[model samples]
Target chain A: MEKAGIPVVQITAVTPVARMVGSNRVIQGHGIVHPLGDADLPPEEEKELRRQLVQQALEALKREVKS
Target chain B: MRVVHYLNQFFGGVGGEEKAGTSLEVHSGALGPGRVLEQALGEGFQVVQTLVCGDNYAVENMDELSVRVLEMVRSAKADLFVAGPCFNAGRYGVAAGALCAAVQAELGIPAVTAMVPENPGVDLYRQELYIVDSGSNVAAMRDVVARMAHISLKLVRQEPIGRPSEEGYISRGILRDELVERTAAARMADMVLAKANEEPFESELPVTVFPPVPAPPPVRDMSRAIIAVVTDGGLVPLGNPDHIPLSAATIWGSYSVAGIDNLEGGNYEVAHRGYDTRHVLEDPNRLVPLDVLRELERAGVIGKLYEEFLSTSGLGNPLGNSRRLGREMAQKLKGVVDAVILTST
Candidate 1:
C-alpha cells in the first residue's frame, strides 16, 4: 500500500527488506520481539519504551512523504 | 510480420457494458489500440486482423474461446499475437491473458499483453506470456501501445528480449544465462570495489520484484479508528501450537488477546529463530506491546484494538512468498481494521 500511497510505517529490525520493499516510513525496531521494549527492562521502563516507539510511529503517520 | 491483435468489444469501438455480451467478430486490418500501435511497429509489420470479443464471452467460454481465437490466428498466418495492455479491467485482462497463453502454446507464436501490476491476470499469466506494464486504463493507451509494439516486433524478428526493465515488460520469472566476459571472481571483486567507492553497481542476479500495491488511503481519523497490531516476530500461543516455522515460514497464526490487557509470562513465547528469543520469552509484551496499547486505549488516543494479532516468521522468505502472505493478511484485515501497524523482525 505504500506504493499506492497508503501511509505505512514499518517497525523493523530488518531494515534492508524494509528499504528494498520501499516502505515510506520506517522506524528501526529496537529488537526482534522487543520491537518497542526490552524484555530485560522493568515494567515501568518497558512501558515507557513501548510508549515512545508507538508515539514515533504515530508521528511517522503524520509526516508528509515527498516520494 | 503479420500480427493478430485481440480487443474487447469496447476497445474495438463496438460498445460498452451493453456490448459486453457480444460474441466474437473479426475486423480486417488494424483497429482501436492496434491502429495506435501500427505506427510504432513501423513499415515492416502489419496488424493482419483484429479479433474482437466480449470480455464476458471470452472468460465464460475460455476453452471454446481459446480454440476460436487460435483458429483466427492460424488463418491470419499471424507471426505475432498482441492482446491489450488491458490496463486494470479485470475481465478483459483475464481474457487477454488467457487468449495470449493459448495462442503461444498452440501456434508457437509469442503473445504479449499489457496490464497494471495489480491485475489478477498478471498473477495468472505473467510467467506464461510477455506482459507490458500498463496504467490502470485507456488513458495510457498511447504509451501502452508503443511498448507492446516494440516488444512484439522484437519477438517477430526473434530478437533476444533483455531484462524486463530494458524491455519495459514484466519479468517472466525466467533468469536468462548471459555469457559475461568477466569471471565470477572478477565480477565479485568489481562489485566489492564499486561498493567500497560508494558507486552504484547492479547486482548480477536481479531480484524478481513484485508489483507495488496501491497504498490504502490513510485512516481519516485516528481516534475513531480501530487499530490492529501485527508482528512477524513469531509470537505465538503457549507451546507454539500451530507449529509456524522458524524460517522461510509459509504459515501464519492469529491469536486472540480478547479481554487480556497484556501478555503474561508462560502464556506466550517467541518462535522466531532469526534473533534471540530469550528476551522476548521473558515478557511477551516486549514484542506485542499490549501493555502500552492498552494504555492508549484507556486514554482514548485511539479506539479499540482488534481482538487478535497475526504472527508470521518472515525471515529467509522469498519476495513472492512474503508478498502473498502480506496480501492475504491485508485481505483478511480489510474492512475490519481502520489501520495497521506492521512490526517486523
Candidate 2:
C-alpha cells in the first residue's frame, strides 16, 4: 500500500499472529471474547480492556523501524 | 486459631433443591454445615467466620464477590480460608474455586478446596489454587472435610506439607523438591548408563537451559523499505467469513484496502474461532485501526505501510504455524517493507 501511496495499520486482540503474517503496523488486545469486554460484564471492565488495547495500538504506530 | 470456612448453599444448611436460589450471606457462628469444619479443626483451629454464598452468586458476580469476600476476610481476621467438598455440583465447585483464588490473591492467605475430578471447576481452578480430589457424592463428606482440615492446619501452622502425590491433592504447578535416598553421583551415573543401554532411568537432577536460535539478518536501509502488518486474530468478512480453524490454521489470507481510508462495516471481520469476534466485528477498527497508521505514514514516520494485511487465527495454533506464517509473510514483505511489526493479544 505504501508503494501505491496508501498507509495501513492492523489491529487485533492477538498481535503474535499479526506479526507472524507480516502486517505493516499492528495492535494488541485483551482476550478472545470481548477484545474489549462483554456487555454481560460491568462497563468499567470493558472500558479498561478497550483503553489498554487502544494504548497498545497507538504505541505500535509510534514504533520506529529498527531493521 | 483464626480460620474461614467456605460452603455452597446446600452445605450451608440453606435447604436443598428447594432453596437453590438463596442469596449470599456471611454468618459469624457454626451455621448450616459448618459444624463439620468446626469438629475437624478441633480446639486449636477455630472457624472464626463462615462465608455461605450461593454458587450462582459468586460466578455471576465475580468482581463484586471478590471485593465483598476480601473485605469480609480483612475484617474477620482469618489466618486461612477453607472451601467446600463440592462433590459433583459443577457450579458449586466453580464458586468454591473462585472464592479460594480470590482469598489467596487478596488476603495472601492459604486456601484449600475439595472437588470431584470430573467437576469442571477442578480443571479451571486446580492450577490457580489447591483442590484436593474428593468423592463424587456427599457420602464422602467425613473423609473429605477431615483431610481438607488436616491440610489447612499444616498450611496455617507453616508446616512442611508433603508432596501433592503423597498428600492426595491435585498438583498445584509448584515444583516440589523431594530428597531421594540415592546419592547425586550414583544417580547421574545410573542415568548415563541407562541412556547408553536404552533403559528407563529415574532422573534426580534436571538441567534448566535453552539454546538460543540464530537472529534474522538485518535489513539494509529504511528510506526504501517494505513494511507488512500481520495479524492472527482471525479478522475477516462476516458474511462469507474466512474461518481459520483454532490451533491448526495452515492457510492465511490477505485483504486488499487499496484506496479505502479505514476498514468499514461489511468490509472486514475476524475469522478466528479461538476468540470472540463480536467486538472487532462491531467496530472493525478494533481489529485493524488504519486511522492511526495512516497518520504515521503521512508524517513520514514510515516510508509506507504494506498494501494488504495478512491474517489467521492464532488461538492454540502450534509453533509450526508460527514458523510457516513467519517465513511466508517475511517472503511477501521482504522486498516491499523495510521492517515488520508483529503484534499479539
Candidate 3:
C-alpha cells in the first residue's frame, strides 16, 4: 500500500516484525489477537483504549517518515 | 527414452508478438532449442514430440491447457518432460512450470524446466518442479539445458539429487537429511568465527529479504483526509459471507459498514484460526475497532471513514500472497482513501 502512495499505519503488537516487513507507519497495539481493544479491560475502558489507538494511528498518518 | 518438449511461440519458430495468441499445436521431432535439449539428454533420449503454444494463450488459459497437455503427455508415454530454458520470459516460464509439474505428478514422468531466479514462475512452481536457473541469458541455453537434462536423468534414475547451487536450479526449499562432518553447533561456531574475523560465510538457512518499500508522503490535511480501515485479522460477517479462508487466504471481502455505526458481535465473526478469536467473537470491534473509528468520523477528526472494511485472513500467509493482495487493495483504494489503518494479528 505504501508503494501505491497511500500512507498506512499498521497496528500490531509485533512492531519490530511490522518494521522489518517495510511497514512505514506502525502503531503499537494492545495485543496480537485484539490489536485495537483489550479484552481484559471493561467495555468503556476498552473503547477508550481503541479510541486512543485509532488516534495514535491518525497521528502516525500526520507525521513524516524517515528512512 | 522418449522426451517431450514444451516451447513458446518465439522459440517454437512461430512469429513473435503477433503469434502470441496462437493456440496449442503439436509438432514431430525436436524444434529449435528442443534439439539442443535432446542432444544434452544424450544419444538414448529422443525428442519424440514438441508442444508449442503462444505465451499469452498459454497463461490466459493455463488450467484448461494444462489438462489438455497432461492428456497429450500421458498418451505420448514420455519418459521425461522438458519445458523451456525460458529464462526470464514470465508467461512462458509459468506455462512451462505448470506443465512440468502436471506431467510429473500425473504421468509419473521426471520433468524439468528452467527459468531465471526472478521469473515469477520460479517462485510459483519451484517447490513442485526442478526449475534449473537459466540466469536470464538466452545465450547460455546450452548450459541451462545440460543442467536440466542432468537433473532430469538423476530424477529418472531415482538418484539422490544435488543441492540448488550444485545443480544450477532454483531452491525448492526442501531440507535434506544429510550426514555431514560438522555438527550444527560446530557449523554455527565456524560461521560466528568467520563473521567475527570479517570473512565471508554462507548461512545454512537463507532468509527471505523483502525489498524496501519507500514510505509514501504523509497525509497533508488530517481533518479533510479520508481514511480506510483494513485488516488481516479476518473479521467477517457471520457465516463468512464471502468465504474468506481461515488461513493463507487468497480472497478478501469488503463488508458493508455503510449505515452501521459499530460492528455488533452476533452479526460478525472472526475467520482467522491463528489466534484465540473468542474476544473478537464476543465483540468484533476488538479486531477492527469500528466503534472508535465511527466516533472519530462523527467528531470530524477525519473527513470520512471508507464505508466498507477490507478484510482477509493472514494465518500462515506467504509474503507473495500478502504482497499481491496489498497491491490489489492499494489499486482499489487509490483515488478515494487518503490513508489506511491496517490491523494485523
- The numbered model that scores best in DockQ is 3
Q: Rank the candidates by DockQ, best first.
A: 3, 1, 2
TM-score of 3: 0.80
**What does candidate 3's lDDT look like per residue over B200-293, in tens digits?**
9888999987667788999888888889989999999999998999999998998889989888889988889999998888888888888888
Which of the two, 1 or 3, has more lDDT? 3
Every candidate's fraction of true contacts kept comes to: 0.50, 0.11, 0.93
**Model 2: lDDT of residue B61:** 83
Candidate 1 residue B280 Cα shift, in angstroms, is 2.4
Q: Indicate the TM-score of model 2.
A: 0.49
DockQ of each: 0.47, 0.07, 0.79
**Lowest summed lDDT over 10 consecutive residues: which window, candidate 3 chain A?**
A33-42
Counted clashes in each candidate structure: 5, 39, 0
Q: Candidates' TM-scores?
A: 0.68, 0.49, 0.80
* Residues B182-267 of candidate 2: C-alpha lDDT, one tens digit per residue: 88888788889999999986554444222222233333443344566566667665543455565578777777756766666566
For each candidate, the alpha-carbon lDDT, in order, equals 0.82, 0.66, 0.89
lDDT (10s digit) by residue, model 1, range B29-81: 99978988788889978898999998888888989989998889999999889
Every model: Cα RMSD to truth: 6.1, 18.6, 4.2
